[model samples]
Target: MEVKLHDIGEGMTEGDIISYLVKEGDRVSVDQPLVEVQTEKMVAELTSPANGTVKEILIDVGKTITVGTTILTIASEQGADPAPAKEETAATVAPAAPSQKSMIMERPKGAPLSNRVKAAPYTRKVAREHDVDITLVEGTGRAGRITVEDVLRYVEERDNGKTKAAAAPEKTPSVEKEPVHQPEEEFDTIPFKGRRKQIAMKMSQSLFTIPHVCHYEEIDMTELLDFRKELKAMDENISVAAFFIKALAIALKEYPVFNAKLDEENEVIRLEKSVHMGIAADAEEGLIVPVVRDADKKSLRAIHQEMKELTQKAKENKLTVKEITGSTFTISNVGPMGSIGATPIINYPETGLMAFHKTKKMPVVNEHDEIVIRSMMNVTMTFDHRVADGGTAIAFTNRFKSLIENPKKLMLELV
Candidate 1:
């Protein structure tokens, strides 16, 4: 049975082979972890498909390969035979201690990789550090590729080429010279390929594809704050962002256009009934959005609890693919993080994203025309102008504001 890298989720096109948990000639059970693969979003373990003994290890570690690429082959326990191995050449070596199989390094569709590189850059760097010729070293890694370990071993053997040099005369010791000092590097380089790269690509595509128009609104949070204070006195401490999500869900029901996807290929604006709210979270890896599935159906308390758990998981890089996908709309509660205002990029394919800024005590003209100190917050609604007009966004913001300003109104809309 050929074990290929299958699509896990989120339509991931490629993945990096982080490491192999099993080597050739090792017996593996069904669903046993065989390799740890890192996708664009998260790290996942690809398990064995059948009860089999691994026959051939194909790809090398740290290489990002496309989906459907045959990574390895297995000899199933149901009397299946291993595939024919390539005839070993002078450069070939066993994949494992007990296996006669050798590794084959190639890209998808059986296209051979270039033969120019004997070793990777880091491998050659190791040989250079020891003043060893990399071209003279033998390769033991996949497809006769030299690895760091191979270079180190060669250096050791070369240095210990017999304690006695067969009666060769010892040379006189030269005077010790002062060691030269080199200035330390003043810069550090961070890898830009994983989550950070994903964010950049996603944002760029969203920004360039959709014509974004940002709408701003000032909301009176005085009533909501007083209501929350009363709840706090009764020890009912719910997150303010949870309330925002609940109110946004209610608003989405009335104006469902914002909760939609613009499929240009079909030339239709698809409106979603279920409000899967994506909560923008800052994780150690990068920005991640964990979805609250069916926010419209969930109660405020349940939404709050799930949102809290998902945020924690996202921060710890433990979120599953389902928890991070299928968002109909997104929300960034930057209030706690002290953001004044921001035109957030729409979570692409989704028509819109709402950002809640800091709530502060500001003087405002009230309904009675008296300047009063009220807790006010600014909300920025970023949407695809092609899908919805500014007037529609303003109306949507006003509807959301009315619900949040009057907590009782928001409670009445709860299912």
Candidate 2:
């Protein structure tokens, strides 16, 4: 049986082979990962079609292959004598001689296979990159397949061991060394591919095509902070950003223009009925946004949980195409990284992007004219000026600020 590249997702016509998980002569169970491929949107692992020994790998690492192309060949018979590892690379392997009583099992189309590890291809790559043996890492994914999180846990434990070893007293005395400097600067050039390339293209298009205008505001988050504390006391694992997302979603109802895509080609604004909030997450590969669908309908706890899962998937490079697309509005939060503020570029097509900065304690005059310390956070809204005027953007931010300051309004219906 041959394992050909299948349609991984919509609009995915081709993918570059990042690496091969199984080499020729290696025995692979049905649905076990065979190769890792990098598509335009994400990196995914192709799996074996049947339980067999890999007879030949037709694609090489870094080679881009079209959909339906034969990726590898397998001798599908169970309990057959395993072939020895081949030293020479070949494009094709000769088929085994015909036998009247061949015990090869035929897999039915679209039928679920049992005893297969369920994991994405990128998860396997993470294990390989961290030098963690995935077989030893227990999976938290569907079934018993190892996940990137499992591999990360193993690496963290292994690193802690190394740290403890380094902390032990050394027998030899430490020697002081003189500093050395190179006269010429040197750097390695990595080719722009996969996520990096997609980011560059989209950013360029958004910047050049959209006429952007930014509105900056600061919010007194003392109440929201107190609210979050109360929620935390109840053992709810919610984030301040979740409240912000909820506030933004509610505010978007009043300002539908913000939660819209500008179709410049058609000269019209398409308002999204359901709020799909894209959360900007910085991953190892690059920056990616995984959207939370129907964000307006979800509670703060639900939003936080979804964001946590999506962010984890993003970091592990396990985000599917649907997870990364169809966002009506986006929030880029740099507060965790201690950024004071940033003027984020609009995510393409979406009319606006909300940027959140670090929250800090600052003295401010209250309504009673008394100076008091409070938690303050900066927010910047970057929007398409053509789709929304400056006044409208400011109005949207004001409504969002009111919701944040009030805290309870976020849970109330817009009406």
Candidate 3:
């Protein structure tokens, strides 16, 4: 059976071969991870479809392949003779006709996973002594030489920094315990087609496709902070981001235009009812946004718990396609990251995005006109101009600020 690269989601056309979880000649069970692939959105594992021996690996690490491209050939062990002096028929030997032979020649069978290696006599001796598989050890020495140190370090880190090979444990028959693809050595130029490439494509699309208008506002976060502190004191814990999400949901409900997509092809702005808020997170790979589904209907605690779980999943690169898609609105809480202000790009197809900047104590005039210290945060609301006007953006932000400033009111809106 041939194992082909399948589409994960979001119209994924291609993926980079990260590593083979099960090595060639190893046995793999059904659903056992066969290989690790780096897709545009996330790193995913392709599993074995049946119990078999990994007959051949057609693709190599770092090679990019498209969907339906065969990457591995597995020989199924189910209902087959273990000891083969098994008879080979004429069909198995070669094509019967000229036309069929030509068709077989046209198809490219990717190079087998088994590859040749180069090493010095001393390095070879060291590798053999340590029982390290020299063929799997990538060389870092001059002219791609497999050095002794490289072999030792691979043994040491056989487990740490498990980006590629870590997904498969020792219990799995397929994993060969090779080091995951780690960019250990410095390079003058790097391949530009992983998470970085995806971000570039999406950002360029959003910028060129949508006319962005940014509105800035300074919010007094003193009330919200105090409210949170009081809640913490009373053992009622909730994150400020959750409150922000809830308030954004309420404001989105009021200003339904902001929670909309301008369907240019359809020539109408489609306003969405359910609020799926995408929480932008900074993971090890790049910027990831995991959606908080139905933020409008969830309470502060529920939002907080879900946001915490989503954040963890995003950081770990374990978020499913459903968890990252169908977001009607998005928010980038850069306050913790110490960003003062930024005109964040709208998560394409969504009309607006909110970015919260660092909050700090600043002197402000109270209603009585006396100077008082307040926690102030800068926020920028970026919207697609074709879908909404500046007045509407201002009104939307004002409503959001009103809800954030008066926690009691925000809670009332929530209930």
The candidate scoring highest on TM-score is 1
Q: Flag regions of model 2 displaced more than 4 Å.
A: 1-15, 21-35, 46-59, 64-185
**Roughly what TM-score does model 2 have, to 2 decimal places?**
0.64
Q: Residue-wise lDDT of candidate 2 within 1-415, one digit each (tens)?
A: 7677777764344577899988999988988988998876678888887888888787788876656777878888765434434422223434534561242235453233333444455555556766765655666743455655566676887877743346667788778889788698788999866767556646755775688888999999999889888888988757888888988988998899999987755877899899999998998888888999999888887888999999999888889878988899999999889999877999887899999999999999999999999999999999999898999999999999999999877667532
**lDDT of model 1 at residue 174?**
90
* Model 3 misplaced regions, further than 4 Å: 24-30, 50-55, 74-191
Model 1 lDDT per residue over 49-81, tens place? 899899988889978666777788889999776
Candidate 3 whole-model C-alpha lDDT, 0 to 1 = 0.83
The TM-score ranking, best first, is 1, 3, 2
Better of 1 and 2 by TM-score: 1
For each candidate, what TM-score against the reference?
Answer: 0.74, 0.64, 0.70
- After TM-score superposition, the amount by which residue 140's alpha carbon in candidate 3 deviates from its true location, in angstroms, is 28
Q: Cα RMSD for candidate 3?
A: 16.5
* TM-score result, candidate 3: 0.70
